[model samples]
Target: MALNRQLWIAIASVMVIAFVSSLAISFQSARAYFEEQLHLKNIDNANTLALTLSQVEKDPVLIELMIAAQFDTGHYQRLELLDPSGEPIASRTRATDAVGDVPGWFAELAELRVDPGIAQVPDGWQQYGTLYVESLSGFALEALWDTTVELFLWFFGIAAVLGLLGSMVLKSLTRPLDDVVDQAESIGNQRFIATPEPRTLEFRRVVRSMNILSARVRDMLGEERSRLEEMRQRLQRDALTGVGNRGRFDDVLGALLADDDPNRQHGLFLVRLVDLAEINRQLGHQKTDALIKELATRLGTVAGEHRDSFSDDHLARLNGSDFALILTDLLDAKPLAERLTEAMQELAARHAEATSLQLALSAGRFGPGDERSSILIRLDDALARAEHRETTCLEWATQGEDVDRLHGSDEWRAILHDAIEQQRIHAAHFATRRIDGRLIHREAMLRLEDARQTLTAGQFLPWARRLGLLPQLDLAVAESELERLARTPDPDGEPIALNLSIDTLLDESTRGRLLGLLASHTARAAMVSIELAERAAIDHPAAFREFCAVAVPLGYRVGIEKAGLAVTEIDVLHELGLSYLKLDRSLTTDLAASESNRSYLRGITGMAHAIGLTVIADGVRSAEELTQLGELGVDGASGPGVPE
Candidate 1:
């Protein structure tokens, strides 16, 4: 029961008991007073009648006439005159009837019985006759009943007013408790929240303790996340230069290529220090390290500028005396190549007096259909050509080679809009299976069908995002998948994971549309899981948390895809209430080798499992890799090797 209700019940019970006791006492007191008054009247009337009879005459007829006259004038039940021998001389009596408007039960409860009055009649010192008179108690019973009714009405009215007032007071007093309950529920949902302290001392103390506990937990999570990020940086970054290490570079390069966004064009620059070994032989490792660090800084500066123009760009030191910088959305590599050439000349001039340290710069641009190995090979060939030509030379290969043949963003936007309106999007399923060969779930990949070609998400998502058409595309894809599920529910009852773009997930309008679509098809919600990229989740933690807060309760599972790349901050995962974490393919490739990778995966899996999240490895290529990942505690794997 609610606190307010319990309080009201108690208050009402007390009021009823008090009202009943008061009514009983008042009724009894009134009845006693009325009986005393009647008794006095009876005695006084009888004495007066007897005296009148004695003064009038000793004759029985005269006495009887006077008594009868008095009896008629007053309200009396019975009046009698008796001779000295105790024989009745004359008597008058009348039957009593209950008054109207009073219940029989109430009259009986309030009835008053009084004794009749007796007096002797005197005539010259001799007893004339004995007179007996009794007053009627029907009127007294009626008065008692009326007073009792009035008392009951007054008590009931006052008690009702008090009950309402008490209820209001209880509601106010317990309002803080409601807030505390909501706070507790939010915490259970992995959302740490605090409530204002109540006015009551005990309640305020409880609230304060909860707030303190919440803060402590948040602080602890923050510390753990910081530690994890530090570890990630140590594992992925070069010790001499603060740029990404070879492994990190390979992961980023693979991800960019695997993304296969047709509209995306990435520029790669490979810089080789021609005289690094000679410089180190002459000036020692210290000066060589200084030179490498300076070059890394310059490359980082260029990457930063490129990132400002295009959000996805990276600089990494692939190996000793060699560094690579990748730029996204740069269709032309000539401009960036020229900039690097100028920066290299300046760097060489700075080291002119110390040593003849020249730099060889080679640049290549890769796009949707380009393979990572081919791009690297072409970049290496360009570097060789630069080194052979001249000192401090820069060369560009495959320039203006991978430009898009389709229409501009506006036309593509129009086409995408038309496709969405016509519901031309379809979903492709890729299976992920557990170690025991049992099916876990199929990941639903979106495809946009045009008159000419059916484009995969990687081929069209970049353009869709650039054109601000992701929300529409996402809605269309979700609607299609839901319709499919409605027709044929998953045979294994496993949900199909659907990817959601960061913009679509965060946009309020898009979120509403998605929710409405899901609400209408609630039965399919349980068979649907929403997947957000790890980068997006890290970029927009608050938005992701809010999205999950709304989605999870509606029976939609939330998971993170491409985890471990941009997920240095693991604390957000705890707050996100993720159902699973999909290890990016870069993290899982060749898992049997590389102790460093194995250690990182172990740490990630442990952390995820601690928070009740299953870890699934993506892009598992071989049986060996799958077995290794399973041994490492990965719950599931999905890739070419895994059966569909």
Candidate 2:
């Protein structure tokens, strides 16, 4: 039982016991008082009657008439005149029937007994007769019952009023305990919250201890998070130039290309420092490093000027004497390339005045769906052409003459619509396993099929998203996966995870359709897990939360994929009630060699685990990386190194 109920029961028991005891004592006292008063009244009446009869003339009829008058007027049970030898000469009797509204049980329990009064009457020198008088107890019994009922009413009313007041007081006094419980629950969810200390000394002490503990935990997590962020920056940045390193640049490029949005254009510029060896031989390594840093700074400035045009632009130092600039959505890349070339030339001119050094800049532009290797190969070819033509000659790759069957947005939309309508989407399964080789789940990657080719999500998803057809496509993928899961039973009974697009979650009709489909397949629903990108969840938290509210109760697990990219919003992890988080490949790349990345991963994994979320490392390319991830407390891993 709750404490409140227990308290009320205790209080009520005490009140009832006291009331019953008091009523018993009071009823006995009132009954005794009535009996004593009746006895005294009978004695007094007998004495007065004896005195009056002694003074009266001796007549039988007169005596009988006097006895009858007394019996009629005084409400007596019996009245009689007796001789000196104890023989009754005249007597009157009345029935005892007037006990008003008192129950028989109560009258029996509180019955009052009274003795009749006796007196001697003398006529001149001799006793005439002995007189006897007695009063009925029915009236006294009725009065006692009334008094008992009145006493009970007062006691019951007082007890009820006191009980209500006591309940209110108890609830107020224990209200702090509710706050304590809520705070404890929040802490369990990895949300460090504190409650105000109660005025009661013992409760106050307990609350104070809990608050202190919460604050200490919050401080520890905050410090660890700060250190991890610093380490992450060190791992991603080039040490000398403070720009992105080669690995960071590659991760960004892969993400951009994988998006596959045709309208999103990007330009890649490769700047090579010519005659770096000559400069080093003459001026030393320190001067060459300083020159490279200065060039990196200049590239950052040029990129910053066009930041609005290319929101996802970045600069990186690829290697010695080689730096690259990547800009997005630059429809006219020639002007930006020309401007960057001029900036490098200006730097080269200033450096030449002091030493014999030159800068050769080559620029190349690649559009959506272009392979990363092909872009690099084409940029290398352009750089070679520039180097052969002259020093510091800028070149741009010409658009290809080869045409795709789906040429425009309308054509691509039609193909995607038809594919979704016909359920042409298929899934590729990848296994995520624990360190001990136990399979956690299989992740599903969506694939689209057509007459010409089988396309990956990267090939067709961007077009679907651009055309507002992502919800339809995602629903189709889910339905197809559900059907497949129903048909193919896994020996291990591992669940299949499907990735959800932001559009699918935000669209009400799509969410409804997906939910209906899942609801129909109750057995298969339990075998399905949905993964949402962390960025998308953060962007539309209300919609994601609403989706989770429905999904979680229906036996569907929800996870956030590519989680580490949005570490700043890590608090949302608890709010979303996620089952797992997939660390982005960028953070997990080269984990075996990078101490900074390891420390960062440890902090992330710890924080996620504290919130009851399993952390899985993505793109684990080697056993060493997997081992390091295990040491850092990662729950599972999936990539080329792990078996499918």
On TM-score, the leading prediction is 1
Q: Provide the lDDT at 253 for model 1.
A: 77
Report the lDDT tens digits of candidate 1 across residue range 27-73. 77888898889899889888887777778767777767876887788
TM-score of each: 0.78, 0.69
How close to the true structure is residue 52 of candidate 1, measured as C-alpha lDDT?
Answer: 76
Residue pairs whose backbone atoms clash in candidate 2: none
Q: In angstroms, how far off is 71's CA in candidate 2?
A: 5.0
| Sliding window of 10 residues with minimal summed lDDT for model 1 | 303-312
The backbone clash count of each candidate, in order, is 0, 0
How well does candidate 1 score on lDDT at residue 534?
82
Worst 10 residues of 2 by lDDT: 398-407
Error of 2 at 146 (Å): 3.3
Residue by residue across 423-492, what tens digits does model 2's lDDT show?
A: 7878888898887778878988878888788877645664565578878887887888888777876633
**Candidate 1 wrongly placed segments (more than 4 Å):** 48-96, 120-132, 146-176, 193-201, 251-269, 277-315, 325-375, 391-411, 430-442, 478-496, 505-528, 540-558, 570-573, 576-580, 609-614, 620-644
